[model samples]
Target: LQLNVFCQTKPTIEASTNIQFSCIQIHYDGLDKQMTAARLNLLNNYWDVVHDFSADESPVANYTLLYEEKAVQLQSAAVFQNSSVTFERSKSTVLSTGNLLSENINQVAILFCQVDNESIVDDPKEPLLMILDIYRQLNVSFVKTVQTPVDAATMRNFVNPRWKGSSKSKAVMAIFIWNCTDNEQNFFNKAISSNNWVGKVNLKVGSDAMDVIDEVYKIIDSNRS
Candidate 1:
């Protein structure tokens, strides 16, 4: 099974304004067909898709088993913080919308699906990893900067492909906590110094989502010269 996600990019998303997501699921392995259930999910520190499932399909697989929907909403402004402060967030009913149309979409959102046949891929691992892959391929990027400096070091070791090679033109910005340790603070500085990408910015942990977006715009503007 393969799943792809496409979103309606917005110039501005308000606290109660709606943002849209379109999820497409394809079955190549043939182990599953006809989605038994589907959902719009939010990504967190553990990327827990199971417990975090929201916007469930009405009547289940009613969409011809394609796993597509257009009614996902922004619900409230607070959910947007989940992406920036990964480790600090607590599990709760942070995401829920029965396709009735509310303002739920924020900086981070993901999709998940379950097929009628449970013979293969019962967990959310595939979809979660798929989103990560999408993030890696993007030319403009944003990451919460990691809760611990050690995690940052681990991420550094993992490396990003766009940050390498001769044509390092992609823009990436890291948002860190205000009280982040010195090592955590230095991670982006070191990464920016070592990477050849167009430019990189480090945002304080408490910075607004718009702040990160603005910094990314600045990097883009600087590179335009």
Candidate 2:
């Protein structure tokens, strides 16, 4: 028997600021009835009678081997059927409960299954890989927040080396702000449109730190292009 499982968040919005997500499970049973019956007895004494007839080891037994084999086959079928039914029913409940917290935050979440990279000879570039590469180049100390929204003031404070450390200890930080309101979006658009952001790569002081930032922007550009 082989089992495959996967989980991931979905991309759908709800209310003013909510999103939805899912998870999936797959299984494959490859053993024949005779093989399965034999294994069952090997693993436990409870199936001794079934295995004895299936393996033709007890020819002198009063009961017919065909009848005993049929009974054991039915039992195995019933076990697999019951397990599959329970699993499908439980899946819905699990997904609902797991994402309940997100509901309050106006978001829906799910676990998704994807193909393993090892299984494929040729794999395309993805945003996740880009993010991972950028993460490796970045200094750990500079990571103040992760996957959270921030205001303009917070952004300014994060970028200012003087506020957090001395010139020698300063590190370049990247902040990801999300779940912004319409007003916030407008503000960002206006700021960028008016060229208010410096948008300059400052490598004079923190050359190594700025290199990481440059790599991150390059990834962003590649993703967009």
Candidate 3:
């Protein structure tokens, strides 16, 4: 039997996150019904993919497969303070797209939370607040933060590098931090509005992050339904 399983169409996942298997496909080569049943039993005994239900006359197959796959840990932090960031629902997108990196090359919706504040260059804690606030707004439980270092020989190369690899992708609420200018913020606004695939939380220096809670909630709520 050939078993192919997919948790999310775009399986990009952060560390310490849980994924529900949404699709599973099994292929058998010239299987007899009796042989297939026995094979399934053997597979179940080894893999435990199916729950035992022999006590009942007929067995029901469970659709969802709970897969807890943790990504490689890079960085982590905890959010103790509650989030008070508000979102501009009028400008929020219903969805965002990312390269699924799957066999079928499908595009999937991705959630992005960006904290474009110059303050983070000096005080990293400020960006953490922004990240935690956005996650709280999205109702995603706080997990340790993680980042992949750009290993380049030179500063220029590190700043502008090309990628040639595939990593697991998932439909998830993402977080980002940028020190943006007024023109850049305008561009970000326009970009997110134009592309329904991404929702952004813009944070400025010294602004009350909690002020955006209602706005953020509205955007997340709209997408939830």
Give per-residue CA lDDT, model 2, range 33-151, as digits (tens). 33344332111111112212223343343222111111111335566764533334122111111111121221111111121232111221221232223223322111111111122
Give candidate 3's root-mean-square deviation (CA, Å): 21.1
lDDT of candidate 1?
A: 0.27
Which model is ahead, 2 or 3, in terms of lDDT? 3
User: TM-score for each prediction?
Assistant: 0.22, 0.16, 0.19
What lDDT tens digits, residue by residue, belong to model 3 across residues 75-139?
33233124322122212111111112223111111222332333332233433344333433332
Per-residue C-alpha lDDT of model 1 across residues 1-225, encoded as one tens digit per residue: 221232212122223212232332222221122222432223222111112122242333211112233233344748755453221111111211122111322322211121122222233333333333333333212232111111232222233322221222221223211223466335534443443211322222332344433444454446435
User: Per-model C-alpha lDDT, please?
Assistant: 0.27, 0.25, 0.28
The Cα error of candidate 1 at residue 162, in Å, is 25
Stretches of candidate 1 above 4 Å error? Answer: 1-179, 196-202, 208-225
Give the Cα-based TM-score of candidate 1 against the true structure. 0.22
Ranking by lDDT: 3, 1, 2
